[model samples]
Structures are given as C-alpha cells and as structure tokens.
Target: MSDALEKAEAAVREASTDTAAVQLAFAAMELAKAAQQQAQTVPQHHQCEHQHKPRRSAGEWLGIACAVCVGGVGIAFASLALAILGGTAAIVVLVLRSMWTDYQRKGR
Candidate 1:
C-alpha cells in the first residue's frame, strides 16, 4: 500500500478528537487524489499526437481497389456470385487485418 494510505490508517487509528479525525481524513483524501492522478497520467510526449492515422500504403490501396472491383462485378451476376464475392472479400479482409496487426507488432 502507499505511504499516504499507511499514514491515513495511522491517523484514523490514533484519533482523540472528532475535529482532528476530520482534518486527517481530508488530508488523506487529497493525498489519495494526488496519487491517483499521478498513476493515471502519462507524459504528453509519450502519447499519440497525430490528428489521424497515416494513409494506407500503395499495396493496401491496390487491395482495396481489387475488393471494390469484385463487389462491383458481383452486382451484375446476382445471388450466387454475390455470395461468393462477399465470402472472398471477407477472407481477404481477415488476411489483411492479420497482416496489418503483424506489421504493427513488428514495428513496435
């Protein structure tokens, strides 16, 4: 536990007057709040400052174009072809997601 918490406990344990206990309790609360703020925060320089994620790469753009073309062609062929196209698009999207995640992990 924190030093402030230990002190708070000691204050509570040894209190002789209601006023003294209240003052100690308030001090303990402020300490707890300060500690919480410190623990929850990160340095501004350590955070992401970009307004948006970087643009997709050339290969990623190409993949998106192919997916869009497949979707467009599926519109002309109707039900069965559309379903196949949708499934293919789903698989491609999953593969791309895994690739992106791996790329990010490696970069980190």
Candidate 2:
C-alpha cells in the first residue's frame, strides 16, 4: 500500500459518514494498491530505447566525399557565372551612357 493510499484510508475511516464518499474513497485506494503492485511486478525502463545506427563503411564515406566535391565545384561555377554577368552588365551600361552623351553633344 502506498503512503497516499494509507493516508486516504485513515481519513476515510475517521469521517465515514457519507456512504457514497466512503465507497469512492475505497475504490480509489484499491486502484492505488493495484497500480503499486503492477509497478513492483514490472521492470523499470526509459520511455524511449535508444537505437544506434551502424557506422558508415569506407565505400559509403568515399561516395559521400565525391558528392561533396561535385557540389562544391557546381557552386564555384555558379558564382563565377554570376560575376561574369555582373561585369558585362556594368560595361554595357557605361557604354550606353557614353553614346547618349556624345549624341546629345553632337545635337547641341
């Protein structure tokens, strides 16, 4: 019997006027006792058992390294393309501005 169940039983005995209250208290005490017994019978354990994954093999590691290298090369190419595009745009803008200024001066 748990400490809480014992206390409740003692309290119920002291004030056992209401028959319904006494019955409810007795039912609760019984449940507590049943749970206590179940706990003792069953083994304690963590809620979640940790499952460890197997370590990567040499072949898997080599494949992963190759994938990383390919990804890095792709990123480098993309950056280089963007830089070229920006430089071309700047040159075009400067050339157009100069042509417009020369045309205006000739007109004046």
Highest lDDT against the true fold, candidate = 2
Q: Encode model 1's per-residue lDDT on 1-108: one tens digit a residue.
A: 699999998887677477787999999999999999997796677878669878999999999999999998887678878789999999999999999999999998
How far is 38's C-alpha from truth in model 2 (Å)?
36
**Which segments of model 2 are wrong by more than 4 Å?**
1-49
Candidate 2 lDDT: 0.93
The reply for model 1, stretches above 4 Å from the true place, is: 1-77
Worst 10 residues of 2 by lDDT: 39-48
| Reference-based lDDT, residue 10, model 2 | 85
